[model samples]
Target: MNKENIFSMASESVINSDDKLALEALEMAKSKNIDLMELLSGGFSAGIREMGEKYASGEVFVPELLMAARIMKIITAEIEELMETSDMPKKAKLVIGTVKGDVHDIGKGIVCSIVKSNGIEVYDLGREVPPQTFIDKAEEVGADFIGSSALLTTTMVNQKEIERLLVEQGLKDKYKTLVGGAPATKRWAEKIGAYAYCEDASDTVETILKWVNEREALKEMV
Candidate 1:
């Protein structure tokens, strides 16, 4: 097949979460000496970003977003494994979870993929995660950021509770806290004393990156 066809096939495989096809596309790209980074960043990341936008705009629903995220995970995992032996810098580590009493995980999963693609290590805590579990895992992993997602208005309050617990335990400043999901806002994050708030998966990366960079700058100033 032509180069464009091969790339298109690869992009489709990634969007569809077809591991076998993705592997086939990888081989084809290697044989044709195509730009792997272009394939990943342009083809794969673009596709997932499109789907994420659709989900955010209500053009697509949760199931579609979940499937797209799944595909993204499969494709990126393969590429990350290859990059491990190279000179590429590793990503930051983040602990993410859906707050307690919230069963919705599609938002968290999407954020995980976006963060992972940005070269961050995302330790996903799944759905209905308690505040203490988040604290424990953040401490356990020495994570750079702790992200909490809540889909419901009632459950969103738990994000503040998490910050309170962290403060009470003297771990409030140990890690940057980020709050997100359908019900989250900058005002809410500020009220909860969170370091940042994201409205979507892509924005979350920018927020985390900014937070990390700012912290590093502060450390240097010290």
Candidate 2:
């Protein structure tokens, strides 16, 4: 199939939560020599963004979004495996995880997959992650960004602790931070001194890309 056709089918797969169609698009991309990143970003991720919108509008619920996320994960894994031997330059590195006391993994997992698909190297710290672990791993990986997800009001304070620890360690300016989840808002991000508030996977990807571009531009000026 052609690029446009494959892209269309890939998008439909996510919207419909069809794993078979998603894998079919992956196969077509391989057969036609279509760049996997393009298929991921322009096709599957595009569909995922739509799902986010629909979920926000209450047209879709958690179950639907969860299924879509699963489909995304499958296709993304395939792309990641294919690109492993290829020299796809990473745009930036990010450490992402669910904050402490929150066992919710759906939102964090979706963010990790989508962000990684955008050519950013993501180190997923997994759910129930301690605030300090984020800092520790980011330090180890030399991460450019640290992202946290909090699905409950009580657990949200851990995200704040991450900010406090960064400042306490004199590393507040060393890395950008993103905060998000069902209970998180832009105001919450500002209150906690996070770099950006991401509402969904697509928003997280866009915000991170913007940060990466702005950082690159600053380097150019320097």
Candidate 3:
């Protein structure tokens, strides 16, 4: 099969959440020595992006998303192992999400992917997530951070609401809060009491690890 067909096939498998098809296409890419990163950024990512849209629209369930994420993980694992820079040590747990009223998760998905790629344990709450959901899941899992995204000015208010609840509930000191999106700025993060604000996946991953490591070191010192 031609390279274009292979790319298309890779995307279809992920969009459909067909494990067999995804694995087959990945194997084909491996054998043909195709650029796996191109396959991911071009085809597989395209498929995951469609799935993200469906998820945000309520057309797909979180389980379906888990399947898609797993497929991408399988693909990225092989690619990561071959790369020069190795993956980070998995040490921190984060509740990642998009705040309520925002149905866009494209940026959230990328951030989650990057965090997972860097070996952080991310419990993605998906798009349009309620504030309580973030707290509940983090508490249940004992996560170290509350990572949030708000693509709209309206929904960004929820970030402050979370901060308020954390203080009201006396849980403010328990978890670090991270916020981001198109309209999210460092100033806004400061105003809302978010620990940090990241502009993109790369920045998010880096900051999260740094914060987690610093916290870990402090813990060790005490």
Best by lDDT: 2
Full-model lDDT for every candidate:
0.79, 0.88, 0.82
Which one wins on TM-score?
Answer: 2
- At residue 178, give the lDDT of candidate 3: 91
Name the runs in model 3 displaced over 4 angstroms.
1-89, 219-222
RMSD of each: 5.3, 4.7, 6.8
lDDT of 2: 0.88
Write one digit per residue (lDDT tens) for candidate 1, span 1-222. Answer: 777887777767756667788778877877888766556656665666676677778898878777766776666666655544334354578999999999877557667766776777889998899999999998998898899999789998889999999999999888889999877899999998999989877788898877768878898999
Candidate 2: stretches off by over 4 Å? 1-86
The 10-residue segment of model 2 with minimum total lDDT is 79-88
The estimated TM-scores of all candidates read 0.63, 0.67, 0.63
Model 3 Cα shift for residue 30 (angstroms) = 8.0
Counting clashing residue pairs in each candidate, in order, gives: 1, 0, 0
Using TM-score, rank the candidates from best to worst.
2, 3, 1
| Collision pairs in model 1 | 91-119
Per residue, candidate 3 scores C-alpha lDDT tens digits across 1-222 of: 878998899899888878788878878888999876566667787788788799889999888988887777676665555542335666789998999999767567667666777778889988888898899999999999899899788999999999998999999999999999878999999988888889777788789879877888999999
Comparing 2 with 3 on TM-score, the higher-scoring candidate is: 2
